[model samples]
Target: MRALPAALLLTAGGFTAAVAQQTAAPDTMVAKTISNYSAKYMDAECQLTKGHYKVSSGATYLSTAIERGSIPENRLRALASGRRVITEAIQQNGQDKNAAAWYYLGRIDLHLGDVAGADSAFKRAEALAPGCAQDIGKYRRVVYAPIANKAIDFTKANQNDSALVYYRRAAAWYPASPLAPYNLANIFATSKMDDSALVYYDATLKATMVDTAAATVKIRNQAGYNRAVLLTRKQRWPDAVAAFQQYLTWVPDDADAKKGLIQSLRAAGMADSASAMEKKLGVTAGNPMAPAAVTGATADYNAAVQAYNAKNFAAAAAAADKFLVVEPNNRDALYMRARSYVELKKGPEAAKAANALLAVDPMSETALSLLGAAYNLTRSSTQAVNTRLRLNALPFTISSVTAAPSGA
Candidate 1:
């Protein structure tokens, strides 16, 4: 999975399909993920010199059924004890040796450190059901600790061997889960199995085209991104470019991957190719939008720019206020409002904007520095620090919070 799991939001994209059957798909409410692997993918073409690629079509869900729910705690316990949830499932009139039951059992064991048991269970699942492994992964989704998350602390802490044991189990339970194969491919890459990594990377992409559990936009983009990074490492510039382009299919605006595509082209000595990428991205030489997306109270946050440029504190403050009223959540407005507060000698108000900015995005560099700078502005330094820290650490994003900016 990418560092950003925003694709989870896209999982809800299939809600329309699910809602077609029922009023609302509970799974849509949880992951908001949509699987379109069943959609077609044969019309892909790649050209290195032209620095271009094309796909004949995109994807959409083939089936109306959408799976919901997380790996049940009981299933995890069962796998740990070398038990099969399929037993209970069969007794309860569910399918015997159901891949779904086995996958959940394996997932629970995987996280609980019963790596060997998880593997055996997964193998059993695969043996019992061959073509359905990937479909089973939909049942093993874990919000807090998805099986694909190899970068998390617990997996790294135990060393990859232990994690690999469970990961392998997950893959066994869901061969269609592109995430497992992709992760395993990275494992091989790190182990210097470039060839093996490439194979698995291909497998990951192939699996992704059919894996319902990983059809979210985030996961889809991540699959392409990770594969492209590996292709770059292998010095397969053409393939690298192709994979990155596929990534753009999901996240057309990912600056990081776009930068990587340019860098890779440069490294491969494909100047024309690199230039075309630049043209595609408009990065070689293009002016940014004349007016930024500033939702200020006034129409001319730009007019206030003159005062701001002149360092006129009073005028800047007045304009900043107008902007704040109209568009408090605006990034530039928030920063300027905070700055204006400082100049107006309103330390608390400035600090409030700093805090507000932090809520919207804790990673904001300007916000972080200003919040630190505002530390000495008032006796409430301790409060400010704690608030800023909490704002930063909260699991959800501030922009996602519908409430107006605190500074407003």
Candidate 2:
């Protein structure tokens, strides 16, 4: 019933530096230890929106409202540094339902890998300004900005050279942004540039997932999940097992991690570990990678798209995780999860998606591209090249960027 702040209102100027140098708590947290002594996280959120979600000066004054409660220094540190979040806020001018706040603040929570925190922010918006959801439905912007849109288009064009040109162009344009390299890393992996993709994926991880100080356990879960998937695809079963094990430690409920662990163990010839995990998750009843029931969870899907577009891969992954909680068989959720892994620099996770993606749509360019990326990043350059070449040889016009004939 309580609300969390909807967004981070990092000012345009000094705030960038504030964010760049933001310090975090150093506690070794296995999971969250939320206490009610802190201000209640209100579920109220605004529906009317203007700009992207985040905090504003008026909401800053609400510091007094929060002052009434005693929050853990660590929690306070998390909030101040954008790791923790408030799901709702009351403005000084008494203006309620600040929809944008939820969107952007969710971004912060997403970046910090706070799935619970991010969800709370969106719930607050739902509670505060329910009308904004209607607008979101009406004028839904394309998730990827113009530059990313071009990259996707170019990749479809199969103009590797020209695609590279545009991809590099976007990367330079958003020099510090993660999505450019994230997308490029996928391509490099597809093109059998596994070593190169790994470099880029590592960079993508740093840009999108890694955090120092008091970061949440979720980021580690995400990064570890991704790494495990990539490693498994590259046939590095031991490392994949270790990575999956690390992911399970953070997200014990991840069916995929459980399945991946089993697969990794089997691949490593550690059949016993694989069997133990299989028995533990009880996948004995059905396929481990079965799609989840995500139909009614449209809100979560929209939120995931926003996070993905904002380049908040961890948050998007978290959103996908929540959706999967409801709908395991949702291919969209699986695809998104794999993408989240790639963006978060978890090659193994991406590989999981890549492999499964082929199952759903073998001819999917994006799926092929992602699989190629995963293979390349994990040191299977030959496989990556093979995948890309197969994609290029498709009957349809392959080069989205270059219109010339195959003979050309």
> Whole-model Cα lDDT per candidate?
0.49, 0.52
Could you estimate the TM-score for every candidate? 0.37, 0.33
Which numbered prediction scores highest in lDDT against the true structure?
2
Question: Model 2: residues >4 Å from true position, as ranges?
Answer: 1-150, 172-175, 210-227, 246-252, 269-272, 283-408
- 1-408 per-residue lDDT for model 2 (tens digits): 112232433223322332343344321220121222223433213334433133553233233233433444544454544322223332322223455565545433433334334344445554556665543222112111444455656766766676665555455433334555656666776566666666655665565554442222322333455556678778888877877876667666565567788778877888666667666654442333332343345557666767776778899888877866665644566677777788777777788777865554343567777888887777787888898887764321111211111111
Compute the lDDT for candidate 1: 0.49
Candidate 1 lowest-lDDT run of ten = 54-63
* lDDT, candidate 2, at 261: 84
